[model samples]
Target chain A: MTTAAGSRTLAHPGLGEITLEGVLHAFADPMRMRVVRDLAREEGAELSCSYFALPVSKSTSTHHFRVLRENGVIRQIYRGTAKLSVLRRDDLDALFPGLLDTVLAAAARQAERRTAAGS
Target chain B: MTTAAGSRTLAHPGLGEITLEGVLHAFADPMRMRVVRDLAREEGAELSCSYFALPVSKSTSTHHFRVLRENGVIRQIYRGTAKLSVLRRDDLDALFPGLLDTVLAAAARQAERRTAAGS
Candidate 1:
């Protein structure tokens, strides 16, 4: 059957393992925080890991993405040679409603404030 | 002139150092999660660290409390012989909006589900 052939079924975290610590740690780094904010802004857009303008090495970038996936922050599905990253909004909402949005909005506002202060 | 004599003005982390990673790592442990949940429930109540029914030893317990305070999750003040712990709701709310309450409620719900399942 072609039912399972279309996509690589990624094992996103269930509600159990999505600890507050993991979520916070995942978004704590400035680079990871930007990745999360961009994902949130893009919503359902399937983003490639390379899309993020991170300052870290390729290995460090991989580590950050792994941390996010393991913590239920994002879902990743393999699409041929590239991996598609999407935020696990439903699971996160089921676990902590408004949390993802709140943090994202706060990050956006902080970014705006920083730009204003810098200029 | 007696200036700031009564209370030891604990130097809490300002908005800068309270990174998402530090906050999450602080509350990631199951014991620390419970402490945060209880603090949220109590609201403004000043809790003694010993109030928690944690499985860890006294010294380990001290470590957990230290992590919480250091991460800006809770504020600690020395009250004579005892150290008083209070959730930094204002700072958290200012930084991350409803993030604190959302996580606390989620934790409560998970605990409830666990109890129901165990029963």
Candidate 2:
């Protein structure tokens, strides 16, 4: 999203402002978790909001992104007309060392377990 | 709580029934997180429900404990007249290894940060 004043900016919690509970709450939702997982997979690369194939209405997707941004789990920036999201891995690791990697690994393991169970 | 049935048992999700989102949701609350932290500190030892002085009312604390049990974050058992709570560390570690430890570590860091800020 952009404005006449150039690129529009989204508000995000500073590293010190991020709470463990807030981050956990943001990741507790499946849709939001999907977003985080995708972003984490890409390392620190910024992906546009439209890049996610969320199984939710546009409004709900926006809400999830907003929740992630507010919780400081992801950093959102406007690039032209696209709003890009990048996982705050560095900030998270700084605040809670190895938390992001542990969570992402756990998420991946859960995915594999569910797939295997289904099969 | 015990009954004519010898020892009353509380319903908790089986290892297969536990979900990452559910665990994260259970830990997302401040009061519930505090309970989990104390239980984690005790390792596998059982602690009565009244062992910790939660700021919330007895009813509210009970609700928090129920949430934790249902989410597979803790196991509750009837020990005499007291309801003992234990962290389901083994089950959780089997399902999502190191997740519980990482979360507890993060929570402790957050507490220290908060205390330092307050002082």
Candidate 3:
């Protein structure tokens, strides 16, 4: 497979392979969870991989984005020079109702607690 | 920290540190997810770690259980010699409503599909 298709495959796992473990595995890392959170909160926003406030390198960021897409968490399409991403809200809701929102809410709470503790 | 508390710490991350990524990380591993699924469906039945049909050694099984509990996915309370485990339904539902159930449902479907494809 070429790099583009390979990346696409990584971009979205088929419905069959989109297990909860796979989805959770894709988002378990802090960076990846942050990426998904941004995607979840962004309304009609197609974010480029660079738009994230990640602490990783460019390649690592690319890798995280690819994992998110491949695990069926996010959908990606090439728009000129940037590969834009959006959460697979419909698909996710169909497979696991309320999970996306719950996780996002939990993450927000955690973020707030972290900030509060640091301050 | 002693091994018991260290292990307890592994058994449950505090409420403050429980994020989507952490919970997902706890369940991402197939073994751990399986354990969680069984716990979720047990309906008040507290299972022992040795009762699982895993492909790992005793020590690894212990480790997986530790990861699950520490992440707040399940509650581990010792009943004499046996460590009885139960899914922390209230806490999980509070933190991420319907996530555990959704993930379990998805996992069941995945298992069925895998079985059919293999046959």
Candidate 4:
């Protein structure tokens, strides 16, 4: 990435490199799904790793973000020691059409359903 | 009850019991995904376990199908000696709405893209 200059760059799958199974596996976990949902809320604005208050340990959290990046669901870059992440919305949409949005929306609905049931 | 009377029956998650992560995890595997795609092609008709010519062994195939059923992605029932399977499209659609169709369509597109690339 142009923004990845001068920092230890991370590897990500390009648009053509992403697969449906890989993306689904990355999203299958609750932690990774939370990161995706949070990034999607920003409307394309990149968010720092610290922005998401995950429930897991720091190392586990790192692993989650790495999975997301490696699966081509999100793009990660080191912006001066702050690893920022943003959903690869354009690429994912172009590759899978409505898959990402459908999953995200489904996730939101499930969250709401759980909350309602709990109440 | 009637169809399952004289044969072994399988338990499946009810509409309210299916979770987003559970469904995603079930769809994340290649073997289970193949079963899903095959079932989707049947247009809701229940196919027996042997209907899918999976490369995996019988036990492994059983495990995969069990994963799908437990996650609420598919329904399995035994008629005599054959365990028939079908996508829980109605239940899934009622709960997750367009999620199933979107994933299936994206998978079809991905398969076509891969075939074209290979050609």
Better DockQ candidate (1, 2): 2
RMSD after Cα superposition, model 4: 2.9
- Tens digits of lDDT, candidate 2, B1-119: 43475456767788899999999999899999998888888788899999999997999989999999999988888867888888989999999989988999999999999999999
Candidate 1: list runs displaced more than 4 Å. A1-9, A15-21, A116-119, B1-9, B15-17
Candidate 4 per-residue C-alpha lDDT over A1-119 given as tens digits, one digit per residue, 9 for 90 to 100: 67536558888887889999999999898888899999888889989988999988889889899889989998988878799899999999998889998999999999999899999
Q: Judged by DockQ, which candidate is best?
A: 2
Per-model TM-score of chain B: 0.89, 0.93, 0.85, 0.92
lDDT of 2 by residue, A11-110 (tens): 7888888999999999899899999999988888999988998989999999999999999999888867888899988899999998888888889999
> Which candidate, 1 or 2, has the higher lDDT?
2
Q: Which ten residues in a row have the lowest lDDT in candidate 1 chain A?
A: A1-10
Model 4 CAPRI quality: high
Q: Write the per-residue lDDT of candidate 1 for residues B74-102, one digit (tens) a residue.
A: 99988766788999999988877777877
| Model 3, span A53-82: residue lDDT tens | 699889898888888888898888876567
Better of 1 and 3 by lDDT: 1
Clashing pairs in 2: none
Model 4 off-target regions past 4 Å?
Answer: A1-5, B1-7
Model 2 regions lying over 4 Å from their true place: A1-5, B1-5
DockQ, all models? 0.48, 0.85, 0.54, 0.83
Per-residue CA lDDT of candidate 1, range A1-119, in tens?
56665466667778786866677667667778889988988889999988886888999998898989999999998876778799998988887777788778767766876788689
